[model samples]
Target: MWKPILLILLMIFIGVVGFHIIEGWPFLDCLYMTIITIFTVGFKEVKNLSPQGRIFTIFIILGGVGTAIFTLTKLGEILYEGGINRFLRRRKMEKKLKSLKNHYIICGHGRMGKTVRERLEEEKLPFVVVDNNEKKLLELKQTYRCLYIEGDAAQEEVLNKAGIKKAKGLAALLSSDADNLYLVLTVKLINPSLFVLSKAMDEEAERKILQVGANKVVSPYKLSGLKIAQGLIRPTLVDFMDLIIRRKELSLYMEEFTVKRDSDIVNRNLSECDIRRTTNVIVVAMKKPGEDIVFNPSPDIKVETGDTLLVLGDKEAIDHFEKSYLGGIS
Candidate 1:
């Protein structure tokens, strides 16, 4: 693109200089004559030409006209290439968005929204991001290799384009409380069943957002304050949590699994199933349907259908336990 533009400028400069030197015309007249000759606009000359000037005009015609055509060709190629690439990219993005189902939709690409997206990516979950900032969305697409839509997330049409109807969850992390509130409401109207997590800056906003069909509302400032207090109060406990949550140095992890009806250990107790002997994963807690979670459930407690098990151990052991006794539904 720059190459053709520079070529055009160079050609113009050469034509102006050549006309001034060869025809000895005033600067303005020479410039006008050069423009007419280069473009071949069929305009009459400003003054009669001498033999040398006529010969010089012929040279200008050959070089300047050819350069103009070359520049126009380059311009056309640039436009065609750019237009087709944009068209193809948009088509590809639309196709991918259409094929996504049970995926998460992120309503912003700000700090909290970015964190949520990173976590979902780590979990190998499918998700799409929505934001009104085109440059930011382009950066995200390039850096994270993620799908995104450039539009206001608070609008119903944008949410629909993000496939809110088919999404299992949505995170409304818009910049303002009013925006988040409106987005949550709009999302519920689009898909009442979608689990919405939103960000709020104040208690009142959090309450209002929750009332507007948001399943969860997080206040970053509140969480940060609580975390600071906890870290000072019980540093060891916080460190332990951080270790497990990050799983950077330690292979240990905590995971939850749902017990399906057809699993072999559905009717069996913990001891009867012998999950520890088989996979070395401990049952940290279990929640049966319509019941509160029971922490550190006894070995005699029987495993039942629709039970959610929260276990802690090495990732591989936990995976093996899931496959062997927990119906592999994690």
Candidate 2:
């Protein structure tokens, strides 16, 4: 913006001085003549020009032409790169939110929500975030590829825009317990089956959240205290667990996969399946369909439909099980 203005000012200053020296014209007349010449208005020159004035005119043309070309090129680049298209895309996402279904609506994108989003990303879960802060939303969009609806999470219109009716779950991590409780109640009223995980600031709020139909209520402060104590008492174990949870290279995660009727592992015993040998994953527990959980089950225990197998493994091993053992081929 300033570049074009500066270029024009420089041209006009040069033209005024040159014209005064060559034709003895006033500053105003020289300025007008310079404008007309640069704009190619074809106006008559105020007076005849000397050799110096002609050279000055050449310089003006050279500078003005380059400036004009640069300005036009920048404008073209902005349009070509879809600057306006991206704005329209965001508007479209907002419009499309009204009809979204089977989506997860996340209220608040703070620390807890960030962790939840990370886990969701690992599982490739689709979700939309709602927050009042535009700056925070911008930062989140830049860091994590996800849809966002900017508004107060407690409001019905905001929740509706987030497609709460179609949403399978609502994770309310609002800073306040009262807000989370209100959000939980609203979500439950809108969709009775919608699974809700709310944040509670205290025990009283935790109880209220449960009463309001929140599937789970987590208190960050309480959890942090426990974690700190655990770190002090069992530092080595905590460090190892943290490494598994936080390190992308290790990519270790605990996952529970349910066996479907058609799953290849439905009728296979642990020994016969040889998952440990094949996938290098540890079978931590086998949760039977209608029986107690078998922690560290023996090799002879048979896998069955509707049973969940809790395993600890790297992402690659989990991917293999999800593909080869589950229905997914890749």
Best by lDDT: 1
Cα lDDT, all candidates? 0.87, 0.80
**Per-residue lDDT for 256-278 in model 1, tens only?**
87788888889999999888888
Q: Where does model 2 exceed 4 Å of error?
A: 1-3, 6-10, 13-32, 40-47, 71-86, 91-103, 118-124, 141-145, 165-168, 258-281, 286-294, 297-308, 323-326
Candidate 2 global CA lDDT score: 0.80
Q: When superposed on Cα atoms, how far off is each prediction in RMSD?
A: 5.0, 4.3
* Residues 1-330, model 2: lDDT tens digits: 456567666766777777777768888988887777776677887777787777877777777666656766766766755576677777777777766777788898887777787777776777888989777687765543777878899888888888888888889998788889898998888788887988888899899899978987888889889989999999989888787766565668877787888888878899998898888888999888568889999999998888989989987888787777877742
Per-prediction TM-score to the true structure, in the order listed: 0.75, 0.75
Clashing pairs in 2: none
In candidate 1, where is summed lDDT lowest over 10 consecutive residues? Answer: 135-144
